[model samples]
Target: MSATYDVYIKKLTTQELGYRKGRLMTGGYFYISKSAVGSFFKELDKYVLNDFLRLDFNDPLEPGNIIQASYVYHNDKYAKENGTRNEYRIYHNRAIAKHQLHFQPYEIVVFIKDGDDNYRIEHYTRNDKAYRILENIIEDSKIRGQHALLQLSEYNTLLNV
Candidate 1:
């Protein structure tokens, strides 16, 4: 049985502008200056909008950034994209049958900073369950011949031996 799931990105507007907790130094950073705060809000707005735009469409299984990695397992090999490789640690396990029945959702956070700092998009998996869900989603998609979207030449690279 095959099922479909929708992937969406939501806007996050809470800025963590605060204290440093340590043995000797306890300090707070405030967004007091109007210009600094205004500029920060503008960047946040753009970041959120970009995330929303990226989720406008549907994919059978979106492998997040893993699809860009060079994956080789057993007898299969998947070429890396953009000269980058993905590395992950499987902290827990879930039954593949149950995971296949329920698709997973991916949450990506984009941070924007200026001057010496630049913006970054961060991937967050809230829990081990969420991680399994996503792993199963990508696995199920591969089993159904959906790896073409990721440009993965073979399927064995993602299988658990």
Candidate 2:
């Protein structure tokens, strides 16, 4: 069977960000940001905005629904709390994404920024158990010394329209 996921873009309206304040991702809410948003847009069309939508929702997001809100936009603080310090050592440090729903076996990693003015990635799995499975991917990447390639899929927010 083939795996599938839900993906969409959320337009970042001037009303959302406003002239001075940028958007922020509240606890579980999706908010806009000033710094990283630009980059997010640049890569929005290639990466998975939300979670892996196709991972069967036996438990369901809500009480009866099969699909749950798996992923969401991450604010600076929340990202810092869940992510490693080294990963977000840049001027505007934050995790690009977060897994809000529970879906086993699948792991989601979102890289934001690094100290060397590079990039930082976030890893979000179905649960703690999947960490090991994801570790290998990370290890292999590190061992191969390959730079992670992130493309734009569909952003939860739309920057242009």
Candidate 3:
């Protein structure tokens, strides 16, 4: 299994004293490899926006910049959004399974803005305590929404996976 990392952006808030504070915000999570991270940054530099600079994992990121990145492998195989509709129709040989055979990341290009006004992209691997804290924050925020909480069984399954 590939390593999963929790990605987030620090939202910056300006105070009356001309200082800025950063608040942790969810930018979604993904299961990706370290090499993929470098490739992603390369693409981000080549394409995306003209003003946006390429991320340097060795150094710090720039503030007030936007990162348009997505979970690499997550996609609806039969959807019309991309070219998958035709590909699935032509190659599908069996009934679609209810459960996914592999992990499907939350497919979305998480747009992260340096809210702290500091040039840094915060990321935590699965083993970090900060990862757990951010996960709790995400769960709490979701609970506050209209959706019902995940059942204990489902939560357990997620943890095991």
TM-score for each prediction? 0.17, 0.20, 0.23
Per-residue lDDT of model 1, residues 3-117, tens digit only: 2111211211122111225122221111112122223222222212111111111112442221111111111112333323221110111211123212222322212222222
**Stretches of candidate 1 exceeding 4 Å from the true structure:** 1-117, 128-161
Of the candidates shown, which would achieve the greatest TM-score relative to the real structure?
Answer: 3
Each prediction's Cα lDDT score? 0.23, 0.28, 0.27
Over all chains combined, what TM-score does candidate 3 have?
0.23
Candidates arranged by TM-score, highest first:
3, 2, 1
A best-first ranking of the candidates according to their lDDT comes to 2, 3, 1
Candidate 1 yields a Cα-based lDDT of: 0.23
For model 2, how many clashes?
A: 21
Better of 1 and 3 by lDDT: 3
Task: For candidate 1, report its TM-score.
Answer: 0.17
Q: After superposition, how far is residue 72 of candidate 1 from its true place, in Å?
A: 39
